[model samples]
Target: MMTRIKYRFLPFLLVIILFVSTLTAPVSYSVQEPIMPDSEEARKILEDSLSIVEIDHEIERITARQQELEVTQRQLRERITVLEERIDERRDRADAVLRAYYMGERDHLLVMLLSAQSLSGFFRILDFYDMIIQNDQQVLQSYNQQYRELQASRASAERNAAELAQVKDSLLQQRERVLALQQQVDGALNTSGNPEAMRALIHEFTLYWENVGLYEVKRHFQALASAMENLPGFIQGSKNILSTNGKVYTINIHEDDLNGFLRSEDKLFETFAFRFEDGKVIASGESGNLSLLIEGRYSVVDEPQNAIMFEVERLVFNRLELPDTTRRSLQDEFDMNFYPKQLISFLKATEVSSSDQRLIVRMELDL
Candidate 1:
């Protein structure tokens, strides 16, 4: 009996050990990978993103135009009010002149000329009467001309107001059309029945593009700064002066030649630095005038020269790279036919300040 019980207990113990071993064994499962920006799916997504950005900008422009039209309309109304007041005043003046002349004065002038005491006095009185009549005629003519001008101005103002109203209506229609396009883009992106997901991806892409583009731009500036460091160093106790407008300006003195002029010790840039975001480029830095002057060894006595506002924006635009298809999509979507035009639009959208020896640049663009 004891031996049978031991064998039965051993089998139960073996079964329990087998179940524990199964639990301890590692299990493998598959996970979905993130979609790469270079993938075809990403390309389609980017296209949609581009359309969205374009539509957003279009809406902004249309809204601005509408506001501008409203401003014009208000101005026209104000002008009409002023003209109406002037017309009323002019009419009253003309009425007064007509009443005074017709009711009071023709016989009086004749009587005064007849009462002259001498031949010379009589001639002088006659000339004065003639001049008075001529002046009255001129006043009437001036009133008539002013009335005509008022009528013309009123007509022009009315026409302009009407045109502006029509233009505003057209802008509203355009805004609707833009909204329709945005809806279409939404529809396309939501084909997977998860618009939120698509939007999330777009958001991610925006962040990714901004980060990558910023990195690249920062790198470019770093490279430029490094290259600029090789420029001729300012010597200690040297009179580093620049001249413009026939006035000489002294450069700030530094301890050693390695502390180059023009913001050399500033991180990643001596002349300028930049960042990209939101389809705009902002640049703020010291002008390259000092570098050019120093490089060329230009003389102060030569001529009064204007400070050259550096075209650093051109460099920022040129250095930026996007796939050819992406560029074409930008052109079609935003009507940005040229890279420089796109850069300009972006710059207009961004705010920048580059005064008092500091450089700051911020640029934005659709990736």
Candidate 2:
């Protein structure tokens, strides 16, 4: 009995040991590091890769849109051409009918009626007169129908041509935008010197622009507020900045002031107010010699809760001709390689002042 018990207990003990060994076997296996190196160079390389990927993706989307627009425009043009050809054919037919009438084709019918001899002949002439009248009426009706059709076709063709023109214009504008964006990416990539570094910077910049939406702006503001909660200076500044509706922070820096703001160099941040109509900026105010510029345009849409959105239509630069040194410094600081256009439909405002001049800044922030 003791030997039988010992055999069974020995088998159970062996099974437990096997189970424990199986569990510990995985732990004993050698661990390998990830393929990517944990260093700045690797990070930079990864970032660069991401940037290129984003640019490629954007280019693909834009190309696809362009192709679609081209196809649509081509189709519209073809339709218009067909309509125009039909109209031309109808016009030719109408012109032929008018020419026949003008050439005295009706005089021959009148002479036939006068040549009737007896009562039977007169009856036959009357029947023949009705036939001539019917024939002439039919021709006139057909001419009128063709003329109306030609007019309709011409109108349709004109409309189609106009539509095609619009599509072509839009396609050209989109292509220009794509080229500009591509150039920007290329410039950023080339400036880094290192291909990997360039890629990384591009990726970072792309990501920065991509995520800058209304929701992201609120999150950023919240994070900033949280970070400054315990700071003594921030706490003091926050109290003064708080307003009933929102907050107002004044920057007394000469560069920040609208009156002395260098419009030429700081065109990107100029105080050109927009006139909003039906949620679109229809016009922009021009700057004069006077420093104070007031825009009395009312908001088309109801104000959004917890946020304000402004559309930038124009940029007004300061008229002051600065010294060469100062001008160069301003240009360098503001990255003033491109001049801000008056018809800036793309620029959105992220911040604004409450003053009558309403000094607004178009920032990457969504607000």
Candidate 3:
């Protein structure tokens, strides 16, 4: 009879347990269904992103051309300098010869020709005069050639400078275009149907890019990976000033320490970055067209044991907060728990607080 009574009470106990859990669980339930984005908004997002990419490419091209222009300007400056020096030297030489030619035109050459004693002498004087004229013509031609070359170089330098200015203007214009596209992207995302559906789609796209591992993102990870490989290793390395002298030992970990480790540690989280504000963590990551922001808090879990744990307070994807239902579905992938096993052999964390630049964790021996 006692056994039958115990079995009958089992169902009642289970119902009570579930009801209590429902009351205690975090309240993130949305009364309305998540908005579902239709085709128009989706198309706008794609168009804006692609336009931004094209603008970026154009900016790169303009920058390269500017550099080329700068180099050409330098070469032209040197050329102009050499030409000016040569022209000055030629001008001096031509001045003296030109005066002699001018004097011959008046009467000096005619007097010499009239004083010739014989036919052969007269022929020699005439031929000598012709030679003097020819020589003067050659000198004048050379001087003019140098001046023309110098002018051409100066003109080229001016044109190149103008082109560089135009290139800079083009770059600025391209910047405006990119900014416009960004605004369009924001507007489209904001007005899209069903924020939750947008989040789900963003999540999927982020996961896809993470798995595929774009070259730039991979390079970013590789750079950080050489310094820190995992979260534990990163946490352990942050023991710059270990406080082992007292009963309580402490270590300060900054936002970047965790961000670098997380990004370099997992390719999925390669785009994630962390920021600390008012003792809360504002972590964000970008995957393809969507950006993921997770705001969380660290606290000592009270019920089962005093263990340091991070709880996600809000999850936003592409500027839209995921419904509790959506977060519950996706939060596992963003799960983070601090394990300071290597950091402290047996000390237990009692409190976690934040300051201006870092999160300070206070640990005391369990005994």
Rank list by lDDT = 3, 1, 2
Across residues 253-290, which tens digit of lDDT does each residue of candidate 1 receive?
22133234334555434545333334333443443211
lDDT (10s digit) by residue, model 3, range 240-354:
7356557878777777766656656566656667788798977677855545666877887644555567776876554544333333323343335555544566777888976
- The clash tally of candidate 3 reads 3
Candidate 1 stretches with Cα past 4 Å from truth are 1-45, 95-117, 127-131, 134-138, 141-145, 193-197, 204-367
Provide the overall lDDT of each model, using Cα atoms, as 2-decimal numbers: 0.48, 0.42, 0.67
Task: State every prediction's TM-score relative to the real structure.
Answer: 0.40, 0.32, 0.41
lDDT of 3: 0.67
lDDT of 1: 0.48
Off by over 4 Å in 2: 1-100, 108-367
Which stretches of model 3 miss by more than 4 angstroms? 1-37, 103-106, 183-367
Tell me how far candidate 2 lies from the true structure as C-alpha RMSD in angstroms. 19.4
